[model samples]
Target: MAIDITLIHWIYISFILAVIGFMLFRRDTTIVCVVGILTLAATSTLSVSASITSLFNSFIFAITELLPTILVISIIVAMSKILTKSGINEVMVAPFSKIIKTPTTAFWTIGLLMMVISFFFWPSPAVALIGAVLLPVALRAGLPALGIAVAMNLFGHGIALSGDYIIQAAPKITADAAGIPVLDVVNASIPLVITMGLVTTITAYIILMRDLKKNKTYTSTSTCSSSPIEETQEGLMSERMKKILAISIPIIFVLDVVVMFTLNLQGGDATALIGGTALLILVVTTCFAHKKRGLEETTGYLIEGFQFGFKVFGPVIPIAAFFYLGDAGFYSIVGDYLPENSEGIVNDLGVALANGVPLTKEVGVITLTGVGVITGLDGSGFSGISLAGSIAQLFSTAIGASTATLTALGQVTAIWVGGGTLVPWALIPAAAICGVDPFELARKNLLPVSIGLVITTIVAMFLV
Candidate 1:
């Protein structure tokens, strides 16, 4: 059957094209989302009166859903700010500096710390913490600021945030679309993630090596100007603050890890656990910051936290709203759709391709991987995983490829692109925190990431 594109399809395609056009010409996430939403409304025949309303409603809904998580992240960030002001953040990483003497070790240490913290806390918060503390160490150890940016970008945001095994954001999207268990998707994502990490990290190491050699031959060093490091004044509970933070942060986080293992709360539950712990830490930190005015201070910190959250996620809201429209669950929010249609443009596309394209298991896996990488060009890794999961569904048939392999490949490619490597915009947090150029970071990651992606694809062919 010839694929019949409907009004919904046209709306979606127009939105995507508008985003693409904006990216090419504008490169602003906010503008791209606004243009995309407007185009979608126009294509859907929404009334002028309803267009803005729909957009606002959609935006509000998306934000509300994400607000709790963002709030938790904000609290953590606020606590990190408090920690920074107290000079404890610097103190925390002081030990690591002594242990990691060389530039290479410093780079990897920061990268590894980023990866670990990001896996539990997330990339944004991890970036702030690591950048505030460890970045100086790396730079002082002779690592280029750009190099630190790349390491954090790849290991933390790109790999850890993209996979999000502990957080479950990525898996939840994929699992819901595929109608499979989240744990299954998590399991499937592991080998592909490991392979991609090895490929990308090794390639990144080689690039770092070359850069190091170049630095060796040059006496002129482009020293990064010192980033403003804020130190909070000691509150009434200064002594207690020191003890609590030193003991509390690690203890709670460690408990979270232990709980995750004991209960097998692998995905969303794990994220919730970590977020919950961060909230507790936030309250404790604020209490220390204010003492008698703890309540007021906590509120103040919460507001600051929300402001930071909004700053980081405000641009993402509309973008996610536009992408949310592509999902069946939110298609109605975008506009009324034709009857008999399920949600998401990518899912529809996947179904059409699955039914029409005749292929073997290997080809099916490769095709799914390509679909993931293509959809990921939008630079929101989670946006495309639904399509990946839909593709995974096709390959899960009796005669199809292994669903696990298909899912893993889809995750690896989607994340690699949207998480950091290909898109300059996606590297904003790490790049900004490191005080480096986002475009340069993206460019540096390209070759290493591409080689890793290819190697991962080949590895998936055999393993999956």
Candidate 2:
């Protein structure tokens, strides 16, 4: 069960630390990540020319692994776009708006509704779906735009994305790296996700209510985005048509969820089912909305969706490429350079260190939470989670801990911090959609998010 530590292992560890260092300062990690890959390749093949070849090969591997996730997100975004253009998005949330009569109701109603929509649409598009229609209704209820932004950011990105029960995008990446079942990660995440979601959203609501009572309206006027989503044009489709599609789309997605449960589809299979359904909805909705120009409009929507997907994932791919070297990817990228006794560099290190160091459960929990928060500093919220899963595997193997619990803890912390609640730049989508300052929204979320993370980390410690 014991294996020797090699030079390649040291290289992987050092570069991981370097990547974390870069992220902590809010700097990009792409260059550090690539350099790490090239170094690993160079050491493995012992040939500069071969090392260079392996660098590109690593990216190809990453893209191939990530393409399905990108496609599903792109297709869903395209579907949301068509819904917005046809004014169906408005129709979807209209029923909920009737129940919102006060600031407290506005906050909870929007936050909870955002959590649900985000489960289906992902948060970026969910922000678009909820904010445009529900924001005005929330604002009219006496909540400031900043409060509205916080609700959407926390509930959508913080809660929904951390769990990712529908898309399974976040869990898929993490579980794959941990070498465990995707449902293992998903099932383990349920409690941690609930704790984080309830703690953060409730704390945020109480504090926001206090602030709103002190100041009835916001004073800041600074905006980051050149355009806000509140400026979307009037409905393109007829009112009857918009209403029909609005009813039909949610039913289709609901049925997809039912199918997912019935078939026991958790990872890529579930995602494909949703993606294919979204594509059909997008095509059908575009035809009705654009009439004579439906064909051209559908292409344009697909192009925009793909652009959005790539732009969001551009920073992710390089970091993912670097982390993949920790396990199976090392053999693929670095060739046959690992020691004969090694299971994988990380697993080998775990066994060696476990014998020598004996990491306790408390230490394991804290380290994972720290790694999650630090990796999230790059602001993508997702770019470094492969590292989290790999680290979880190491610590779990070392300390005889629960890999699923540790992975879930890291996943929750990462999303709550960088999934738009604590990071200013990451807050842009929610901020722009709600017409508030991103930094202001981040500031508002700081205390509640920090408190929630601490509680969740402690809870994870006990779980492990």
Best by TM-score: 1
Model 2, runs deviating above 4 Å: 99-235, 358-464
lDDT of 1 by residue, 1-464 (tens): 23455776666666676665655443655666676666666556557766677688778766765665565556565666666666555556566678677877977888888899788766765665566557656776888777888898899867897678777888888888788888888888788898888788878878888878876432211111223334546544456557656655666666776776678664345556666766677677667666788788777767765666556555556766776566542455655554455435655655565566567776777677677766675566777787788778767774456776687678778888876666655665665555454555666788888888788778887876
Each model's lDDT: 0.68, 0.76
Query: For model 2, how does the per-residue alpha-carbon lDDT over 1-464 read when each residue is reduced to its tens digit?
Result: 45788888899889978975665554667899899999988888889999889899889987776677667666766776677666787787677667987889998888888888678666765565465457656776788778888898899889999999987989999999899999999999999999998899899989988877787566433423222322235757778887888788778777876776677665456657767888988899889888899999999989977776665456667876777676567778777789887656655554454445447889888878877776665465776677678878988998899999999888888777767787655666676556465555766788899899999999998898
Look at candidate 2 and tell me the lDDT of residue 245: 81
